[model samples]
Target: MQTIHINRAEEMYDHPPIALAVGFFDGIHLGHLTVISKMIEVAEVNKLKKAVMTFDPHPSVVLNPEKKRTDYLTPLNEKRRIFEKLGVDYLFIVPFTSKFAAMSEKDFIRDYLTDNHVKEVIAGFDFTYGKYGKGNMLKLAEDRDGFNVTTVSKKALNDEKVSTTEIRRMLMDGEVEEANAQLGRPYKISGLVVQGEKRGRTIGFPTANVMPDEDYVMPKLGVYAVTLKQLSTGETFKGVCNIGYKPTFHDPSKSAVSIEVHIFDFHDSIYGERVEVFWHEFLRPEQKFSGIDALIAQINQDKVKAEQILRDMEL
Candidate 1:
């Protein structure tokens, strides 16, 4: 897939036009997938390129600078991976800035939609764009421009709507299974393995200390069954991950949250290597063990439980 980064209004191609799916697509969850799938179908039928117009930094961060916390389900690189997996032909990343945010509805249509020769636009029912979110699927459909619009309604599972917010809530609650159900895949965290205190080695369970990407949403502080895949080697391993301050070893007030993964039966120098951690199941909440022996015993139990869960998942 071709990725085009656009910070201003300009036409990249004009000959055949394109079918565009526009959204932040944080998780690229089921609802967002529906819009993209429809857009692909429209593109196929009309013989236009399949394209996606997504934004970076998120609109909330640009609009509300005073907020202390803002997290994403999938950062740009991860989002690109998801989009490429879905067979997108072109990916247009629009940098979200104050100036871009101030563009009015009509101007946005004229500059972005029409200028790019987006003959067909697909968006979710609740997707909004333009200054203060004045542009919506309805406006896209009613625009005087000769563009066809398709609005995908809520995608539901078991009568509940699938959404990024709900998925994030599930992760924050340590409901990895529930979040995966909404996401249609496991929730993933990607980062580089960094040097740590190497305290796990003393306990007979060496771990790769991951410094996760700051922009992604972090799951609740707990132990989880996860699949660890080294990005460079493409080797995957079953693992147990802990996401929290090492309460057993240090005072929480003085320590920062950390991600440490113990890959079963693996031994290698993975420090400085990038890896993707896919959360499969929530095993237990992070605890303040009484001593090193207690922590080691609990970790052993966590490994057993994680192995069983990963086996059942068959991934």
Candidate 2:
């Protein structure tokens, strides 16, 4: 799929009218999939181009900078890959800046929608846009006639609305399996392997420390059975991950969270290389032990449990 920045949409090569789905699509969860599927259906039926229009850095980060918090299900790169897999022909990533946020509703429609050759717009029924999110699907439909508008109702699981916020909450609570059931895929965190203090190496369980992008949401601080994938080689490895401040070596002054993974039967330095870890099951909560010996013993036991879980998963 071709990715076009919001500011460059005007300069894009003209294509046939597009059936577009617009949203933040943080996770591209089942709820968002409903709209995308609808867009594809409409595009196929009308022979229009299938496209997706999404915002970057999230509107919340721009509109309420001070109050914003870290929580994103899928970053831009991951979202792009997922959209491609879903068969979208084009993906527009709009820069969510203060200037763009100040645009009037008509200007947004004229500049982003009408001028961009968007003939049909599909979104969730509760979708909002324009300055301060004053524009709603109903209002957009009422204001325009030339463009077709479709509003999809919320998709639900177990008769309850399935939303990215809910999914984030589940991950934060360390409900990996439940979250995966709702997401239709394991919860994944991608990052670059970076140098660590080599504490795990000294204990015989060498690990790869990954620092994820700022926008990525982290799961609860705990040990998890995970599947690690090397981006360059597309190699998959079963692993155990720990996401926390390492209470065993806790420092009150350090406010950052760290994610460390120990890949089974792998021992190659991967510093600076990118890796993706998919959480399959929550093994146990992160806890500090009395000393290094106890911690090592606990980790060994955790590894056994993790390996068994992976064997059972067989994914």
Candidate 3:
């Protein structure tokens, strides 16, 4: 998708009239696909450009600073990648600021709709906007004239609604397989491999430590079967990852959580290199062992299990 950062409504007029889908679309899961698919259908029928309207620094982060910042499932870059893959023609990343937050429902429609020649607008059934999220789909449809407004109902899985929040909950619980099913892809985090303490090397399992970008959401603290992709080489390798402090080495209070992975039969200093790790299966929870001997034993066992799982995978 052609990504455009929008600071004002007037800028939108430069583009051709379009049919738009609007949402934060944190994970771009199946539910989001439902809305995006409908938007594409509307654009095709109306002979208009297909576009998506999304916000950065999610409004919640700006409107309520007191609340803890939640990590995004699909960060801006990844979201744009997904949009491109979905065949969206345009993506407007509106900067979420106090002024934008204060806009009224009518002003938003007037500025983004009337001025930009938006042929049709699409959003999820629970979509809200305007100051303090006071605008609802019903209100927008009632206020707008001469524009088609479509609201897609929530998509469900096994009777439960499929949502970004639900998928996040699954990830936080280390249910990687279930989360991947909901996402329609493996749960991935992209980051740079940085230098670590080299403790894993001493244990006979050298690791590449990845420090994810600030906006990337991390999975739960545990061991997982993962696939590592080197961006520069476009090479993928089976791996095992640990997302937690080295509890068996240092005091729990003094240690910090780290993401370290050991790619099978792979050896190279990947420090300062960017990589994408796709979490495929949850192997076990993080635990503190009695000593290095016990931890090494567990690590070996985990590697065997992870290797078997990767071999059995269809990927």
List ranges where model 2 is wrong by over 4 Å. none
Question: Model 3: how far is 43 from its true place, Å?
Answer: 1.4
Instruction: Encode model 1's per-residue lDDT on 141-178: one tens digit a residue.
Output: 88838689988999999999999889989999998889
Q: Decide which is better by lDDT, 1 or 2.
A: 1
- TM-score for candidate 2, please give it: 0.92
lDDT, candidate 3, at 68: 41
Which residue pairs show collisions in model 2?
none
Could you give candidate 2's per-residue lDDT for residues 18-93 as a string of tens digits? 9999998888888898899999999999999999999887787777888674567898888998999999999988
What is the number of backbone collisions in each predicted candidate, taken in the order shown?
Answer: 0, 0, 0
lDDT of 3 by residue, 203-224 (tens): 8999999998757777889999
Stretches off by above 4 angstroms in model 3 are 66-68
Residue 209 of model 1, lDDT score: 94
Every model's TM-score: 0.95, 0.92, 0.95
Model 3 scores worst on lDDT over the 10 consecutive residues at 61-70
